[model samples]
Target: MKCLIKECDSYDKNQQWDIVCDNLWKLPLSQSVLMIGVLLGNLFFGSFSDRYGRKALFNFAPIICFTSSFLTSFAPNIYVFTILTAITAACIVGMSQASFIIGRIEFIGNKYRVLCVNLQEIVYSLGTVIPGIGSMADIQRTDQ
Candidate 1:
């Protein structure tokens, strides 16, 4: 993203909009926005799940995440991209934690809860790392 931004002088493809210029502060701002969205999702959905049930939120969140993520891909400018990304991030957090994790723990035996949670986290970590590894491999291939 940093490379692309520099290559384009922060302009969108076809030069329709300016993303940022003179500095790259918006990158951090976008990340902070995503974190804020995650925090809000954790707070709201955690309680909402307790009240409404995990299935409702779990079913709903993915739809929102997919829609927002799809919209984000077509964002006309940085602000729009940031907003949609935040929404996507929040939905993902709500779906992954408020619904799935809680529901998984609740259905399992108490003695196994900790182990199950740890395993879940390990799987999630691997899911994250796999993409990074794929990107690294792509970079290496390009370098070669």
Candidate 2:
């Protein structure tokens, strides 16, 4: 959302009415598609990971994610970028979550399983914080 907001602001400042309108109209649709993709990918991959093994999936997902993200960064237009972004979100982020949860559960003893699950919440919070810190840097840079 922050990135979209930044792009919109850039277009608005430049008086690029067509680009601005296109971006504004498409934001909701793009978000909806991404949400659906995430949900569906999660459901499909979660079961597949259970049947197969975590190590292979875990290692492979990051490669797909990184490649998709790298390609997205260089996308020629918004449509291509959005499609790549959705693919990254679905294959990379969605699959990673499923694999991580399954792998985390399998590794720990039954007694410590609950604690481990709770610990993941803390780790995820930390993950959010790292990006929040980067976003603050982005804010500062934009202010300049």
Candidate 3:
């Protein structure tokens, strides 16, 4: 139970379901759904791209990702937020791995392909790390 936890916030203490979801434990379920979406997106898009052409899927994937992300911000409840996040995750995984390689490699000259790939890796790494860095900064600021 949340009461057993050492750091239950007011959200947990007051039993506030009118303002937010009562179940904080649903985070893992939401994350699992998001990963499932990612897996499905990769398999579906990988095959779909092969069948329909990578270019179309390459151009379209970001739109799907963006739309889901945009909708997620306005979600009225945890269920909608979770589903939208899952969709966003799916599109992101599919587009990042599948479309990125196909589109990036084909557009650039042979001489610049390696450089492009390297840049992509650098950008991806930064994207992954920035969140952790931001979280650390936020924690430090709050501690002050």
Candidate 4:
């Protein structure tokens, strides 16, 4: 079992992984994996969607995203968690933002397309920010 944190005191039962930060060194690595995945997804999926149609990627990526996300929660170790996180991040970008926005734009009238995209951006921004706010709030962790 690979462990990301050398000094973490808490263990997650589902993922069988460590929790809480004793040092910040490994945190950036985790974030970097997600960003790299997103970059790869954007680069690859953009061309893929263009060639195969956005609808197919839009329809398929979410199923992959959801499955990877579900599996991430139950990952047996840090390595699996990292791999799954990358997959989840890739799928989120490929399915939610790129394919979805393009697909929605194609179906809307010219005059309404900008408005539709702006609305989608607003919703997506809120969805991203709200959870971050919740996470930032103080919450005590308990041991069983």
Candidate 5:
């Protein structure tokens, strides 16, 4: 369990992560866990929201997203990071697809609901791209 390879500016072995996630094999599993969490999120939060009301669920999405995202960043080990990542991924669905969609569609008239959904897609597309752009910029900055 030794990384005899030399370290670089982007990755210093002494500072890099250890204890449960020191290799690439677990990355795909972590990703799968995150994706699978969406199903669990929908199942759990969907019904919970039904009991509590979609508006309330939507309102909590920001807090859940922020808390999970923040905590995930601070995870000291791979297992903790993976679990928090799944929670964050789950909350992404709970916040947007399940809860907000339910709330917004309910608020809109049936006739205009289609338009609302379409607009939501536009926003979602932007959301997906903006992060990629930010990541690209970050890489470029780091390379500089």
Candidate 6:
């Protein structure tokens, strides 16, 4: 979200409407599609993980996310970047949450599941907070 917002702000300031439109126009559509896809993917993966296993999908998801994010960062054009971002959204972010939940359930016992999940949420929030603090420090430095 921060990255997207920063990109949009930069484009706005530079008056790069063509690039911005090309990159952002399909984002809403992609987000909606990914939301639906994530729902279906979660249901499918949740069932599959229960029957088969979670390790395979859990390990593979991070690789897909890293690769897609790296590719998107280096994309030559707005169209390619947008497509890569959409693919990342669908394949990486969409599947990763479900995979993580399944993996956690498989590894941990039932009694601790809720606590473990909540802890995970707390950790994620802390991760975001760290970056926010860093950004705030940067702002303070610039104001000096």
lDDT values, one for every candidate: 0.79, 0.70, 0.77, 0.77, 0.76, 0.63
TM-score of decoy 4: 0.60
Per-prediction TM-score to the true structure, in the order listed: 0.67, 0.61, 0.58, 0.60, 0.62, 0.45
Worst lDDT 10-window in candidate 3: 12-21
Give the per-residue lDDT of model 3 (tens digit) for 48-113.
777877777878888998899999878777678789998998888877766576678878999999
Alpha carbon lDDT at 37, candidate 6 = 52
Q: Arrange candidates by TM-score, descending.
A: 1, 5, 2, 4, 3, 6
Q: Write the per-residue lDDT of candidate 5 for residues 1-144, one digit (tens) a residue.
A: 565655566853224654233676666777788888888888877877778877787788768878988998788776778888888878787766664655678789999999988998899899999988887784533554
C-alpha lDDT of residue 131 in model 6: 88
Query: Which candidate comes out best when scored by TM-score?
Result: 1
| Cα error, candidate 1, residue 77 (Å) | 1.2
lDDT by residue for model 6 over 1-144, one digit each (tens)?
122434343553213424344345655665665566566556665665566666665666567767978997777655566566655665554466665765676689989998998998899999989988887684633554
**What ranges in model 6 sit over 4 Å off?**
1-27, 33-52, 98-104, 107-144
lDDT of 4 at 48: 75
Model 1: per-residue Cα lDDT over 32-119, one tens digit each: 9989999988888788788888888878788899999999889977788888999998888887786566667778899999899899
**Model 1's TM-score against the true structure:** 0.67
Off by over 4 Å in 4: 1-10, 13-24, 102-104, 111-144
Better-scoring candidate (TM-score), 3 or 4: 4
TM for candidate 5 is 0.62
Candidate 2, TM-score vs. the true structure?
0.61
Error of 3 at 70 (Å): 0.6
Better of 1 and 4 by lDDT: 1
Which has the higher TM-score value, candidate number 1 or candidate number 3? Answer: 1
Candidate number that wins on TM-score, 1 or 4: 1
